[model samples]
Target: MIIGVPKEIKDNEARVGVTPAGVRALTEAGHKVLVETHAGELSGFTDDDYQNAGAEIVGDRGYVWGKSETVVKVKEPIEPEYAYFREGLVLFTYLHLAPIPDLTNKLLEAKVTGIAYETVRDRQGTLPLLTPMSEVAGRMSVQVGAAYLEKEHGGRGILLGGVPGVPPAHVTIIGGGIVGTNAAKIALGFGAKVTLVDLNLNRLRELDDLYQGRLYTLASNSYNLANATREADLVIGAVLIPGATAPKLVTRTMVSQMKKGSVIVDVAIDQGGCVETAKPTSHSNPSYVVDGVVHYCVTNMPGAVPHTSTLALTNSTFPYLMRIANLGAREALKKDPGLAEGLNTYQGKVTYRGVAESQQREWTPAADLIS
Candidate 1:
């Protein structure tokens, strides 16, 4: 099988799909890897590194896409790359298609086999491919929020961990999953008063015991959410619904009620955000004021740290990529039920139920199509 690794073209996106080590692994398995020139440059991997790993360095993006059976990418294909899609071409990447109908339509129209990392489940029903990046984004949410909280950044001028005789900032994290959990970890590390709201009481209980009651865990409700946000100096919107759009738990009214100059880092912005006012931004323009509150909803938060992001992401995705390359998509999906869950589009049809329901479109089960 011939695989293509193209340089990411998203706004301020610097991560590459495959690293030199990943290329070497594929080459050792007798698979050919075509890496576009400078694909891994931003991630601190030189073109020579990929070449030394037995990968062919191609300067033309079209040639890279034109020659490969499977195209491995870090992010979903942007509008310009949409022209490269063709029948039977396999696209393995993070396709948050619930919010991007245009991309979904293009995949179906082109009959592309679209496998989304975010929807891929492991044996334990956990999103293995999405976990690494989620962990990165979750931890960075606090770091970014803290920077934006300074007075010069239009924040409330409050320090995350206040000095002696000054109370620490209040942080409200809306979710208890990987993203929220990691955010809470970082927030608590800063010595801030952290409150986490979630719908799962069991998970909340687990968190409560895990933090020894230092981290406040609240049962998710409109009232609790409102109260938490009202007192929060920084709000982290970490809600997720797998491949579906995140529920808007924090309403515009809630944002209006928050403290003036407070910051909101909506880590769920990739899934259309849990905060009503949240919209996808880029690292170039990461934040905006909404009702006196700041919203930092960069769609590719992990991209800012491409080195760590690429290493962490590729670690999880490489195994699955090898499976598709060696066994082919049909045979691979048939063998691993967990991998089949990653199939968002195949044979010009929506294969993931979450994306289909979110788009109000009909979907055929991957089993039916693959069988």
Candidate 2:
């Protein structure tokens, strides 16, 4: 099998699909790896590193896309790269297709076999591939939120961890998953008052144990969510619904009633955001004032810290990549039920129920095709 790693072209997205160490693994397994020139440069992996790992460095993205049987990526393919899509090509990446109708249609039209890293499940039903980046994004959400809370950044002029005479800022996180947990960890580390809400009572109890009662864990309901957001100095929208679009937990009206100059870091922005006002912002311009509240909705927050993100993401994703490469996607999917869940599209049909229902498209079960 020939695998291609293209440099991520999304705005400020510096993570590559595979590191040199990953390439070495594939190469050692008798697979040929082609890396786009400098694809891993921003991630601290040099082209020479790839060469030493037995990967051939291609000069351009087009060559890498055209030559490889399987094309791996950090982010979904943007519009310009859409033209490179070919029939029977295997695309393995974080394809958040539920919110991107165009990308979904393009993959179907091109008959590409699309595998989404975000949808891949582990034996325990956890999203293993998406977990690392989610952790990074979740942790970064607080860091960015605290920065944007300063008066210079048009925030409420409150410090996350206040001085001796002042009260600390209040942070409300809207989920109890990986993102919410990490956000709370960082927010509490800054001495900010933290409130985490989730629908699962057991999960909330687990979080209580994790935090040792340091943060408030509320049952997720309309009233609790609204009241929390209304009183929050910084609201982190961390809700997720797997491959589906994130549920909009914070309404525009709720946002408008929040404290003036408050900040919202919507970590769920990649899945179309849990805040009604969030529109994807780029790293070049990461935030905007919405109804007197600042919104940090950068779709690729992990991309800003490519070195850590690339390593963390590749570490979790490499085993699956090795499986698919060594056994071929078809056999690999048939052999592993969890990996089969990653199949968003196979041939011209949508194979993942979440993406299909979210997009209002018909889907074929992965089992049917794999069998």
Candidate 3:
């Protein structure tokens, strides 16, 4: 199989799909890998690195897209790359299609076999591909929130870990999943008072046991969220619903009532955000004031640290890539139920139930479509 790795073109996305080590793996396994020129540069990898790893360096994304049997990417394809889509070619990437109708339609129209990383699930019901980036985003959420809390950044002008004589800041996280858990860990480490909310009592119990009262785990409810928000200096929106849009836990009215100058790090912005007012922002302008609450909604936060992100993401993604390559996507999906869950689209059909249901399209079971 011929695989193409194109330089990510999404706003603030610097992580490339393939690394030199990954290229060597694919090539050693008898697959031909073509990396577009400078694809790895932003991730601190030189073109010579890929060349030494037995990858052919291609100049244009067009050639990579046109010739490769499979095209791998970090982010969703932007508008300019829309026409490069072709039938029979496999597209493996983080296709956040629930929020992007145009991209979904384009993928369907192109008839490419789209396998989305976000939709991929393991037997334990964990997002294997999305976990590493979630860890990165989760940790960064608090870091960014603390920075935004400074007076210079139009925040509450309070330090995350206040001086011994002063009271520490309060952080409220919506959700108790990977992102929220990591955020709470960081906030607690900073000596801030923290609360994480989730509907699952068992999950909350587990968190409580793990943290041992270092932070508070509350049963996620409207009143609890509102109360927490009223006292919070930083609110991190870390909710998720797999391939679907995140539930809007914080409404515009809720934002209006939040403590003045409090900072919000909406890590769920990639899934259209759990905060009602969050519009996708870029690294250049990562935050905006919404009803006195400062919102940090950069969809590509991991991109700001490309070298680390690229390595972290590729490490999680490479094993699956190897599986799909060793046994074609069709067979791999058929044999492994976890990989089968990744089948967002096969050929021209919308196979993922959540995406099809969200968009109100005809849903085809991946089992039926892949064959």
Candidate 4:
């Protein structure tokens, strides 16, 4: 199989889909890898590194896309790259299609096989592919929020960990999943008062015990969420629902109620955000003020730290990529039900139920279509 690793064209997306080590693995398995020139430069890998790994360096992005049977990418195809879409070209990437109907339409119209990393599940029903990046984003949320809290950055001029005789900032995380858990860990490490709200009481209980009661875990409810946001100095929206849009737990009224100059980092922005005021921004323009509350909703938060992001993401994704390259996408999906869950679109049909329901489109099960 011929695989393509195109340089990411998404705004400020420096992470490459495949690393030099990944290319070496594929080449050793007798699969050809076509890497666009300097595709891995931002991620700390050089063209010589890829060449040493037996990858062919191609300067033309179109040639890489045109020649490969499967295209592995970090982000979804942007508008410009949409022109390259064709029948039977397998696109394996983080396709956040719930919020981007245009991309979904293009994939279906072009009959592209769209496999989303976020939707892929493991044997334990966990999102394996999405976990590493989620970890990076989760940890970075607090770090970014802390930076945005400084007075110059349009924040409340409060330090995350206050000095002696000064009060520490209050951080409210809106979910208890991977992102929220990691956020809470960092917030607590900063000596801040952290409150986590979630729908799962059992998970909250687990967190409570995990933190030895230092962290406040609240059952998710409108009243609880409203109170938490109003008191928060740094609000991190960490909610997720697999391939679907995140529920807007924090309403516009909640934003209006927040203390002036408070910062909001919606890590769930990729899934349309859990905060009502949150919208996707880029690293170039990462934050904006809404009702005097700062919102940092960069869709590709992990991209800012390309080296770590690429290594972490590719660690989990390479195994699956190898399987797809060796066995072919259809056969790989057929053999592993977990991988089948990753199939958002295949043969012009919406194969993922969550994306279909989010878009109000009819979907055929992947099993049915692939069978």
TM for every model, in the order presented, reads: 0.99, 0.99, 0.98, 0.99
Better of 1 and 3 by TM-score: 1
Tell me the deviation in Å of residue 82 in model 2: 0.4
Q: Model 1: runs farther than 4 Å from truth?
A: none
Q: Write the per-residue lDDT of candidate 2 for residues 173-197, one digit (tens) a residue.
A: 9998999999999999999999999
Q: Which stretches in model 3 have alpha-carbon errors above 4 Å?
A: none
lDDT of 4: 0.96
Clashing pairs in 1: none
lDDT of 3 by residue, 1-371 (tens): 89999988888788999899999999999999999999999899999999999999999889999999889999989999998998888989999888888888988888888899988888888899999999999999999999999999999899999998999999999999889999999999999999998999999999999999787888988898888887899999999999888889988877888889999999999989998989899998888998888999999999999999999999989998999889988888888888888888777889998888778889899988666
RMSD of 3: 1.0
lDDT of 4 at 31: 97
Model 3 global lDDT (CA atoms, 0 to 1): 0.91
lDDT digits (tens) for residues 25-122 of candidate 4: 99999999999999999999999999999999999999999999999999989999999999999999999999999999999999999999999999
On lDDT, the stronger of 1 and 3 is 1
In order, what lDDT does every prediction score?
0.95, 0.94, 0.91, 0.96
Candidate 4 or 3, higher TM-score: 4
Give the CA lDDT, 0 to 100, for residue 204 in model 3.
Answer: 94
**lDDT (10s digit) by residue, model 1, range 1-371:** 99999999999999998999999999999999999999999999999999999999999999999999999999999999999999999999999999999999999999999999999999999999999999999999999999889999999999999889999999999999999999999999999999999999999999999999999999999999999999999999999999998899999999999999999999999999999999999999989999889889999999999999999999999999999989998899999999999999999999999999999999899999998
